[model samples]
Target: MEITRSRDFTAERAWGAKDIANMNGITTRLHWTDQPYRWHVNDGEEVFVVLDGQVEMRYRSPEGERSQLLEVGDIFFASVGTEHIACPIGEARVLVVEKEGSV
Candidate 1:
């Protein structure tokens, strides 16, 4: 068995991640960031979970651009081809699950 403590995780750069596991074709990762990620669409569905701190999740909808504040324990789900970006309020840790090699 493996154990991980999100509080102890850090990265030298924003969006740096540690691979946690791969089951079937899906991948699970723990990420650390203090900066915003560029707007883009994932190749597949994405599940984002805030493990610590807060984040502002921005996305484009048919109506227009929109954003939501994601606090600790909050979860964000992005369907495939959904354009979105994640901006951290400060230093934050996030757990992400998606298809392997997805961007």
Candidate 2:
């Protein structure tokens, strides 16, 4: 077993991540970012969890667009083909689980 302290995580680039695990084709990662992620649709489902700080989770829907403020411990599920983007409110740590090599 391994222990990870999400809040202490850092990266040299925006949305940089530390590989945590890869099992059954799913990849678990710890990401550190102070900027926004590009808008894209994942090829598979995604489990995005905010571990520290806050994030502005934005998505596009048939209803146009929508967004939410994600705090620590908040989880956002993005199903396959869901278009979305993540913009950190300053510095934030996020744990992401998705298909291996998914964008």
Candidate 3:
């Protein structure tokens, strides 16, 4: 099957599949009032762009700690092996994007 690129919500791609082209990023959504998300650390960098609603991104490291609220048009980055958590506040919706081999 062939898949076209999209600019709205994350396009549903075949699980465990890779885009044959340059994998700049993969977009996905975090539903309203969802649980704290767990993501695998990737070899390439990753980011989450807030397409809609509000979200809280919390991250912690042995050297420091950080937490912030993100709204529409907001973007976030996850470092290598950086374990973190995310919570949507008040009917939140977000688009998660990750680079191939980067998380």
Candidate 4:
């Protein structure tokens, strides 16, 4: 078993992630980032959980472009083909679950 503290996490690069689990080709990662990610669509569904800090989640849909503020414990569900981007308000920790190599 392993234990990790979200608040104590840090990385050398923007959006660096630690591999937590890989089961049945689905991967779970713990990410630390202070920058915005590029907009892209996931090939499969995604479960994005904020472990610490806040973020502005922007997405493009058939209706139009929209954004939401996500705080700690917030979960953003990105369905397949949902174009989205994550802009962290500051240094934030996140847990992402999705099919391996979805990016």
Candidate 4 Cα misplacement greater than 4 A, ranges:
none
TM-score of each candidate structure, all chains considered together: 0.98, 0.97, 0.57, 0.97
Candidate 3: where are CA atoms >4 Å away? Answer: 1-33, 39-43, 100-103
For residues 12-61, write the lDDT of model 1, one tens digit per residue: 89999999999999999999999999999999999999999999999999
lDDT for every model?
0.97, 0.96, 0.57, 0.95
How does model 2 score by TM-score? 0.97
- lDDT score, residue 10, model 1? 99
Question: Any runs in candidate 1 off by more than 4 Å, and if so which?
Answer: none
Query: Model 2: how far is 52 from its true place, Å?
Result: 0.4
1 or 3, which is superior by TM-score?
1
Winner of 3 and 4 under lDDT: 4
- What value of lDDT does candidate 3 attain over all alpha carbons? 0.57
Query: In model 2, which regions exceed 4 Å deviation?
Result: none
**Residue 60 in model 2: shift from native, Å?**
0.7
- lDDT, candidate 4, equals 0.95
Candidates, ranked, lDDT: 1, 2, 4, 3
